[model samples]
Target: MTDKLNFYFETAKSAKIGIWEINLESSQVFWNAVTRDIHEVPHYFIPSLEKGFSFYLEGENRTRIKRLTEKTISNGIPFNDKFQIITAKGNVKHVENIGQIVYKNEKPYKLIGTLQDITKEQNLIIELQLSVEKFSSIFSSANDAIFIIDTSNGLITDCNPRSSELTGYDNNELIGLHNSKLFPVELRTELRLFLKYNLNRNEYTLNETCIKTKSKDIIPVEIASGKKFEVDNITYLVCYIRDISERKNVEAKLNLLSLAASETTDTIVIANEKGEAVWANQAYLDLTGLNMEEVIGHKPGYLSKGPETDLNASLLMSKAIKNKESINITILNYSKNGEKYWFEVNITTVFDSKNNFVNFVGVGRNVTQRIEKEFALKSLLDVTNSQNNKLFNFTHIVSHNIRSHSSNLSMVVDVIENTDDINEKLSYFDLFKEGTEKLSESIEYLNEIITIQQKTNIEKTKIHLKSEIEKTRMALSLSIKESNILITDTIPDNLIVTVIPAYLDSILLNLFTNAIKYKSPERNATLEIGYEIIDNYTVINFRDNGIGLDLKKNKHKLFGMYKTFHGNEDAKGIGLFITKNQLEAMNGKIEVESEVGYGSNFKIYLNEK
Candidate 1:
């Protein structure tokens, strides 16, 4: 019996099992070498029953151990359980406890128990349980369908909840189903062959194919071959299937839009948010006479703007883009071949579903022909209106001037016929001669006016404006000297005008003569000539300090035929009228600002672009 007890003690010690005993009457604890090592205590350490219980973890562990110990001591009952305890080194360890009461003379005398450290085993078990729970949670909530297939027969061993939702099949129906059944008939054989290939390889393989649902609907899907794994000595493969039906639908729509944009006649250009051109359709390339290489990475219409393009329209488009707004503008654009065309472009801001600014889409329509026709119509209307005004002026001349001449002649002839003296009759002949001369002069003026109106198609030439003004001033040198007038020419040396040469000369002479003729007697006369560039026009301003007219009272008739001001006998009023017509014939216009007794300024606008 002593040898057997020693053998058992050696076996328990080798197995790292501990033995402990508590004397009930003495309240003392005895710990074997293995039990002392389990608590990380020295072999010489002595312990009491209370001190032994103190090593248990607080709360539930200590309370349960106390309860089990009291019951065993009172009824001599055996106890077996697991508990946690804090070792002497402050390490928490899991332990198994088995205790029984040793009876002496039918009364409980001592409590004996075995203690074994199970920390590593308990941690491994807990890790496995957590891993299984995590896998279950992910499988249930995944977006893509996951299938576990048995590599031997290509049969689906298991599927996730998403698999059931994707295939319209319950978990029971999906289990044990052949993996090929998930694909349509047309792709089933292909899937089988692909799976067979995947079994031999550990890497993933992806294929785009169609799958069949329970209702026979075919759905586009992308199947990714996952890594092969083994369970219970059987090899299995995981397949991740993702539905691509929406993606395929979006691709189809994009292709359709691309085709339409490429084939349409209207120019279409798509620009990035930075206002740089990213893409342009075939029509845009053709319209601009540019290749894609020249267009990409440049702003839309940047290479197409010419001197004739409306700056206002260009600015408006830029402003709209900066503000991320939409705008429509018709602007002149030039092609690569230097040909000009009008383009009506509608640019819209594009945004994503999140309302973020994406880009700009510009649709440009060629409106050159329509714009040209409109300009021609406007020119024709201007000509018609001008001719009608001339007709009205002629009617006034015939009714007012010619009728007065004829009446004078008739009255003089009547008086001469009623006269008895020969000298009186001879005097009437003098009056008759004067009347005929005046009528002939009036007819000559009418002919000159008609000729000016008829010369609208005369070719225009570019002439230095200052040089022309100097020449006109020299021609009127004597008049300027006689009137004591001062002339200041502030027009730039490079200032030039496009007009009929003869018309410009005539206009300059008239302006100089008028300034000299209308000099203010109160002060020495002064004239200031300057030029300004406004938009597409060059405005030549002739400002004079002279005896100005009451423009408020006579502004309406200022340029009318035979309308005279200042009561000067030689005013004729025809000079200004003829000057206006000459300017109009050359596609120019004149405006005047004058105040009574102060001065007059005339601004002539010329097409100098």
Candidate 2:
């Protein structure tokens, strides 16, 4: 019997199968060489009945095997099962367990079984089962509705729970419903035909259509679908339905907001952190006097700021933005035409959820009109204050001059009446007439000053600056010839300034005569007239080589009515005060550069075209 068992074991071993026998009477276990190898034990190793069962994994496999072995030995029953086991070498394996009980004298005798490794086949089966479960879960629980239909008949054969929930229909009510019932007939036919023709070429195709719910409400859905051929000679298709009503609503609101930004009057801009303009609204283009093509891909300063822009405000903007801060400030800015404009600009920094700096948003309101009105009011106030001061000074000078003339006439009358000589009396009468004439001349000079001050509506016309200077020199030809003053013009012939013509003519003539009147006794007098464009003004410089005033002592008196600086008898001081008033009325400015006994340079700034 032993040799016979050896023969069987050798045959089974060669075939890579495992065989075993269990003695019911002695509770001993016998394993063939192949079985021992399957259990990963040496040839001489022995396994008892308990040990043999333990080789099977704990829990289900071992419990099942032991129960079956007990039944097979006690009742002479046969058993066949597949189970997993952990080998002696600590490796997991799948195996088939087949056993039969042999009988002797009407009772069970011993148990014989065969074991075979089926690890690869068993693993593949388990994986397939898991895949099916995963797919079933997704199909039933997915957010989007899913439908399975028979392509040939366009009948909905099955649908996931999500489909019924999404469409407001019971699961049973959706079965066997034709696809056309869910949509308008025309759309249904078009979509079915499209799916039939193209489903075979790709994994999925998409179609956008509206579907009617059970309540008869129509909502848009996006369907993505694919098809497969079934063994029953039917074409089946699977579809995914996504409801886009909420997304569509959001898009409409976004479009409305975009329209508002485009049409609104406030200038809007989107810029990178570096202040390069990337996007701008129509108002921004209009505010800057620039077109879209000229605005984008450049600094915002290219359109809104320039050399005359307020540097402090720009610094504050840069500092705030660099620190990811939002700021609002009123700053000076220039337009494309070099016209000064003002904006109430608000800058906000954009950041992500993680608090990382993204970009900057700027909204600018064109506040030029408001700021210009403010400056106009301020200028008006300044002029009123200045005129009031001049009026007070004029009142005092008039009072004093009139009193002096009255007293001198009284003295002359006394001298005339007390003298018996008619010739001396006539001389005093002549002196009295001369004093009255002087008072008349003083009144006329006061009237001229008042006339210049009253000229607040001076109209400006374009005139060549050099041409105006030459005309004024001709008007003072007598004085220029007597004083032998050389007048040279270095202004460009084409240089133009917008000024009140009378004011320009008067200003140049006064400056020329003043130079001649105050000419140095030791040196020959010369006047150089020139002009250049500075910012928005044409600066005409009248530099003369003549006696200069001590500005430190007579700075305020230089432009005062009837205030004289020099001891020259011809220095009535009315000329310069009138000239200053005329320049101011034309919205011009003047400044003096002078030193005692050196020379005077008067710069007249006029609006330039």
Candidate 3:
């Protein structure tokens, strides 16, 4: 019996297993050399039952050993368990301990068990479970089906629930099967060959293939294979399979919509959220005479911005889109040939699922024809209204002036009819002749006013400002010398303006004639005519030092027909009225400034270009 025990203990020592014994009532303990080595004590060291129990860790491990020891000593109950122990040098070790009560005269006397070092196996188990749990979390949570495959044999080692659900197979039926079962027979060969090639590359390989379900329905799928990895001495290939049927459907619908957009007559533009164009349809390209290269990555108005582009309108559209609001506006854009056209564009802001701006879709239609029609109608209406008002004023003035002369002649004829002396009758004849002459003169003046108002067509040419004024001054040289008028022309020598030739001559003649007619009774009359440029516009300032009118009271009637201020015989009040109308016909305006007794200044603004 001792020899057999020695053989078993020698074998146990070679395996790094420890053995122990406890004697009841004797209160003694025995540990083999193998056990002493596990506890980090000397080979010849001996221990009592108390010292043997102390090798166990405190708390649970020690208490468990004590309970087993007491049961064996009193009741002969046996216990087998694996637990922890602290070495003599304070090292934590995982070990298995088993104990059985030995019978001596039918009463329990000894308890023994084997303690083996299981630290390496236990730690490997923990590490394996941790890796599986981490990978399982990703596998199950992912939307796409994920599979773990043995790269060498092309066998499915593990797969997520999504893979089973997608293939209509349960976990029991899917594991240990070949991955090629998911594809058709013809594609299985291709897939297997593809795996062979990609495994050597050690990177992902993506391919579009068909996957077969349990019902034999072939569904399109996007298959991607990851590089091989080894865990626990087992090599695995991670594969991703994504069903692409929904994505293909979405793309098909988008292609149809794109075709529709191109076929429509209205101009269409699709752009990213930043207002940079990504796509422009056929109409937009044709309207601007631009190709894709000229339009893409550029703003909508960038191609059309010129001297006439409405910056305010473009700015408003930008602000509206930034705030995620749609805007509709009329924009004027120029084509490649420099011809201008108008389009009424409606832009809508698009948002994604998270309510973030994604794109701006704009649709525009050519409205140049409608705009031209409306402009023509507005011009006709304005011309008709002006003509009607002019006729009303002409009729009233003509009737009043002509009726006065006719009434005076009628009264003179009445005196002649009742007179008895030839001398009185003869006196009435001179009066009759004078009244007819006055009526004839008024008729001629009315004809002249009508002629001035009848002018509609204005052909303007560039004329030197200083030269025109000098010509008029020379024509009125006699009147200027008689009135002692000081004519000063401060206009620049190079100043030129576009004006109707006849109107420019007439305006200058009226200005000078008025200066001579309205000379201040208090001082020698002075007149200044000069030109200045402002905002690229030629401004002609006609300043006169003369008897200025009470503008506060007479301003309303200053340019009225036949209105006079100085009551001079030559002040027909027609020159200023003609001057004002002529300025308007030429797209110019006249502004006057003066005090009651100070001089008057007339400022005329005209286009410089």
Give the best candidate by lDDT: 1
TM-scores for every candidate against the unseen true structure: 0.70, 0.69, 0.72
RMSD of each: 6.4, 6.3, 6.3
How accurate locally, in lDDT, is each candidate? 0.90, 0.84, 0.84
Backbone Cα, N, C clashes tallied per candidate: 0, 0, 0
Q: For model 1, which pairs clash?
A: none
Model 2: how far residue 312 lies from native, Å: 7.7
The per-residue C-alpha lDDT of model 1 at residue 324 equals 88
Tens-digit lDDT track of model 2 for 188-285: 87777767766667477888888888998888888888656575887787888889889888989989978998999998888887777888899988
Candidate 1 per-residue lDDT over residues 1-609, each given as its tens digit: 999989988999999999898988887888899999889988899987787889999999999999999998887789999999998999899999999998899888889989999999999999999999999998878899999999888789889999998899999999999988888788988888888788888889999999999878899999998889988899999999999999999999999999999999999999988788999999999999999988889988888889888899989998999898999889999999999999999999999999999999999989999999999999899889979988897888878998998899899989998989998899789899999988888788888888999888888889888889888888888888888899998888887788898988888888888888898999989999988888888888999999997888999999887888888888877888898899888778899999988999999888764
Instruction: Work out candidate 1's RMSD over C-alphas.
Output: 6.4
* Stretch of 10 with least lDDT, candidate 1: 489-498
| Candidate 3 per-residue C-alpha lDDT over 1-609 given as tens digits, one digit per residue, 9 for 90 to 100 | 999998999998899888888776676788888788778898778888778779898999999989886776667667777678889899888777778887788777677777777878878888999999987798887878888899878888888888887888887788898999999998998888788877888799899999999999888899999988999888888899999989988889999999999999999998887788999999999998888999999887677766787889989998986776899999788887788998799999888899888889999998999989999999989988987888888898788989998999899989999989999899789889999998898888788667666775556789888888888988999998999989897787787798887877887888788878887889988998877777856888888888887888998888776799877876777788878777766767677887767889878777544
